[model samples]
Target: MTGKINSENGYVKVEIHKVFKVLLSILLCFPVIGMIVLILIDTKEFSPILIVVMLLQVLMIRYIFIGLAFKFLSKDSLNRLRDVLDIEWIKNQA
Candidate 1:
């Protein structure tokens, strides 16, 4: 837990890193979002509720992908995230 928190820049650096990862993950889903828009446009029907629902679904999908990537991609960050969430991890001592 302490390892993830650095006193160097008052957490601004860590926060920025988190934000960058979130933005990058969302940006990665832009292609899918574009396809959704194209499909709606091609159908020649415009529904505000449908558009909102689709966008929300895309956001949740992006969030799930980002969570999985963080968990599998970087163990360190995963642990850090767990720490941030106040999840307790048992330590085994030999």
Candidate 2:
């Protein structure tokens, strides 16, 4: 993904490329697709608990990617992202 950044009057504006947005949306759909396939393949044995667990696993995978991304960022950039997202737990990690 590519981003254009602009700052004015202490506010930061980030513009994400449309292609990047499309790619990201596709990437995010993989887990959902997998879940659908799983359900389709085993309709007779489908369980709500299994679906919930799969969803939790997908969320964990997403956060793992987010953590990895933060690791590659500079301290200032990480701080900026954490602040923008308003996620308090990230502050402790930083």
Best by TM-score: 2
Stretches of model 2 off by over 4 angstroms after superposition: 1-17, 67-71, 74-94
Per-residue lDDT over 1-94 for candidate 2, one digit per residue giving the tens place of the 0 to 100 score = 2333344212333344578668766776787898899899989988888878877767776667644654555446746765885654312222
Candidate 2 least-lDDT 10 residues: 1-10
Stretches of candidate 1 off by over 4 Å are 1-44, 76-94
- TM-scores vs. true structure, each candidate: 0.37, 0.48
For candidate 1, lDDT tens digit of each residue in 55-79?
7767766677666665565667656
Prediction-by-prediction clash tally: 0, 0
* Alpha carbon lDDT of each predicted model: 0.59, 0.62
Best by lDDT: 2
